[model samples]
Target chain A: MRHHLILRVVTKLLIGSIMLFALYVQFHGDYSPGGGFQAGVIMAVAFIIYGIVFSLQDVQRVLPPWLVHKLSALGVLVYAGTGVVSFFTGYGFLDYAALSPHHPVHGQHYGIILVELGVGITVTGVMITIYYAFTSRTPVMDDEAW
Target chain B: MLRTRSLFATVMLAGVFSLLSALLFVTLDAVDVAFTEAAVGAGISTVLMLGTLALTRRFESPPAHTPVIPLFVVLVTGAALVYGTLDMPYFGSATAPAQTHVAPDYISRTPHEIDVPNIVTAILASYRGYDTLGETAVVFTAAVGVLLLLSGLRRRRRKEEEDV
Candidate 1:
């Protein structure tokens, strides 16, 4: 990969745009065709492309396995915590009306955004974790083997 | 396509098939599903398959047994599936079970209840919050499973190396 100057440069250029597009898909999901799942996969693809082009160690340094593991669980907690918050507000589990006492519609928006964010986070974490696990193993074939 | 002995070609063909299905999804007005199929099914899975190929044999060995029974079984299943679809509602039929069910309620009420432009998001995130939560938990579980399996293998391999 080091010798492949063209691929390295192209990847460097594409990675930022890919990350940007992932964020766009994430935040714009409410109005667009994409959602947390698509955004999360796109985000993971950016890191993975970097890993494939540069090296696994390089990408791992940028996003450590420990951080990814914690993030994976944290997303589930965020989702569950949102439901618990509604419970505290005198509503049943996952009822968005409790999020906003005056305007239940506003609460729904808030709940949806928060939930989607949680979903995106968990998906991104899990995807990166899987990629790292697979790639970190001792390679049966070297770079030139392909 | 199946006749190709190269695993690499098979993986590439699978990605192509996924992309075609994504296009079909778009035509069916399932843009979100199409996006997912394109990204995960075609892009990521293709890359993952390539990685797997790197760790294994590139060419498939000839099967010891004939594939006639498997071929016959596949044909039977395909025919059954096509027959099943014969009774299905026409595409985009308004009175279809999916359109008649809670979908109508979600579509009608989402604008006032959730105030979001994307009704799918409203239903997935707020209306069906429990399902999404469960799905996230499933993703977390998958990650845990993969980590346990792969990481355990590495540790055992290291121990074997130490013994050697």
Candidate 2:
């Protein structure tokens, strides 16, 4: 599998570009056809492709299983924390206005970004985690097996 | 006639189905839906199915029992759905109850209030913030469940220095 010259080179070129596109989708989602979920999947695909081309062990070395597990929990906390902050500020739970009472619009922008980030992080973590989990148990497959 | 095919071929067919459905969504002007369909349905699912195929047998077992019950169920469900849709308003009808309500408010005020050019985003993240939060939580929960089932905590392998 590792000996495939084209797969390695093409994956190298495609991985960085995919991650970049994921970022673009995340931030520019407000004006585009994407958001956290789509971006998160794209980001995961970048790493998953790397794993498939390079090997699961190599990719996991870069993104350890432990870190991914922790991140899977953290994203929900980040999202819920925004609501908690708003609640403490004497506004409705998850209130965007609480972020900036004077400039409600700016507050909305900030709130949206924060929540989207939380979503993106969780999605990326979960997706990669699942991929790693599935691959870990499987025997190293020969290219000819397919 | 698509029976007894290799798992790879079956997955490829599914991927093609997703791409076709995504194209249909685009034609309906549901760009957001199309994007998701293309990305999640056509892209990630195909990969995941391939992964599963790698782990399991490549070919499906021939049906031992009659598929008549399942076929009848599917046909009934499909007919019910089509019957249900018969009374719905035509596509993009202004008088549709869904459009008559808060959509106009969200569309009209989004520029002044949220200042985001994309009203869909504004509505999804701001107006319907809680729902999105719930959806994210659902995704997180699903991940947690999968982790529990597939890969709970494992002892770090310190002895083997096998490089990836």
Candidate 3:
């Protein structure tokens, strides 16, 4: 990794755009072909690419495993919480009308965005967690192993 | 691909196959599926497979059993699948059961109800929110399962090393 100057530089250049594209896909999914799932995977890919180019320790320093694990659970909570909130508002479970009693359509929009955000967070966390788990176990292979 | 013995090459070929399928999905007007297939199936899985390869042998061992029974099973499954499709409607048929089912209502009402430009997102995140919640839970459960198994292995390995 230390000697692979080209790989390192290219990864540094691509990581930012990858993250930005992930955000675009996440938030812009309401109008486009992508959503939380695609965005989350793309976001995780950025960190994974960085880990591959640099080191697992380096990436972990930026996103700790405990935090990643918590994030995975947090996303689920966020999703379920939305439904619970609707229930408390006298609507059926997961009914978006609860979010905006006056304008059900607007409620649907807000609910959709919130749920998508939850999905994106969970996916990003799980993916990075899996990557960390797999990579951390193996002793770093030398550059010539490829 | 079946003839190749190198695990690395096999993994790379699998990635290529995923990419091709993603392209096929795109051509079928299923862009959302294509985007996910391209990102997850082709990208992450390839890297993960390569990581798995690093933890194991680079080349596959020669098969000890004859391919006759496996080949028979595969052929039978393939034939059955093709036969199953024969009873279904043609591709993009207007009168297909799926097309006639609740799809029309969703298409008609989504513009006013959800008002999102992407009906897929509307269905996935709002209309079908309960199902999506279940799906998110499933992903979380899977992550938890993996973490438990892998971390347990590491702990046991460390214990063994300590004993030695």
Candidate 4:
């Protein structure tokens, strides 16, 4: 148990560093080795490692199962909401150029950031949720009769 | 002890190979792909598989004999594919057909069409909106599946309580 605690602390620090690096990658994705999908997965991994080390129940104290479920839905909603906004603005679905005709590039940047955030939220939530679900359930262990 | 040693060896070998594959993906200028592969393939998949292993037996029945015919066919096909790569452009060559063809159109027109600096978003949302929608649906479906499974388990627990 003492060893487990040490391992947990080390993994937590490593996860923190990875998450910070993921943020850097998300922002610098155009010029670097990261993007929305990658950064999202990296963030998910931090939570996954946390779940593995300390048990899912402990991780749940930080991010409850309900919050994860809500976040999962919200993530997709954010992505689709952007498209719906585009549709209502008289542009075809997801046409960000029409978002602001005067400054199209700005519109694109805004749209991309929103979409990436959505992706990040969804990936992180779903990955952690899956881990939670699997780990929370009792494993079937058959005892032999003497 | 021998089994534990072999398990460690297998995991180490897999980790090394996963890292090499991630590097290869990076060299190919598929940074996004590389990132996903490294994170999901090397990191998440390995962790999850190891967790499952912990919950299950380490070893199953040993194979009586290795299947040779299918293995030989797969090896030959893989070799042929690798040999075919000799005629292809070097990794990250800007002049490669991949760079010149669809990518250029997406990159160039994206700024003008959507006015977005990130061509990937432009392509994903506007140019390929349908695919993105499908992906979102798939995620929703997975969530729903989880909910159903859990709810069923809860119902079972209630039934047990009533019986008790």
Which sequence of candidate numbers ranks them by TM-score, best first?
Answer: 3, 1, 2, 4
Q: Which 10-residue span in candidate 3 chain A carries the lowest summed lDDT?
A: A1-10
Give the range where candidate 4 chain B is weakest over 10 consecutive residues by summed lDDT: B1-10
Candidate that beats the other on lDDT, 1 or 4, i.e. the better one:
1
- Which interface RMSD values do the candidates have, in the order shown? 1.0, 1.0, 0.8, 4.0
DockQ per candidate, 2 decimals: 0.81, 0.74, 0.85, 0.36
lDDT by residue for model 2 over A1-146, one digit each (tens)? 23989989999999989999999999998888888888888998998999988989899899998898888788888889998999999999989889999998889889988888888888898888888888887898887798
Tell me the docking grade of candidate 3: high
Local accuracy of candidate 1 as per-residue lDDT tens digits, A1-146: 24779999999999999999999999999999888889989999999999988888889899988899998888898889999999998998999788897988888878887888889899999998888887777474565665
lDDT of 3 at A143: 57
Report the C-alpha lDDT of model 1 over B1-164, residue by residue, as the tens digit: 34888998999999999999999999999998999999999998898888778768899999999999999999999999999999999998989999998988898998887888988888888888899899999999999999998756678779999999
Residue-level lDDT of model 4, residues A76-133, one tens digit each, is 8888888899789887776665567688766666776777677767777777766666
Top-lDDT candidate index = 3
- Please give the CA lDDT of all the candidate structures: 0.89, 0.87, 0.92, 0.71
Models 1 onward score TM values of 0.94, 0.93, 0.95, 0.80
Ranking 2 against 3 by lDDT, winner: 3
Lowest-scoring 10 consecutive residues by lDDT in candidate 1 chain A? A137-146
Model 1 chain B: weakest 10-residue lDDT segment is B149-158
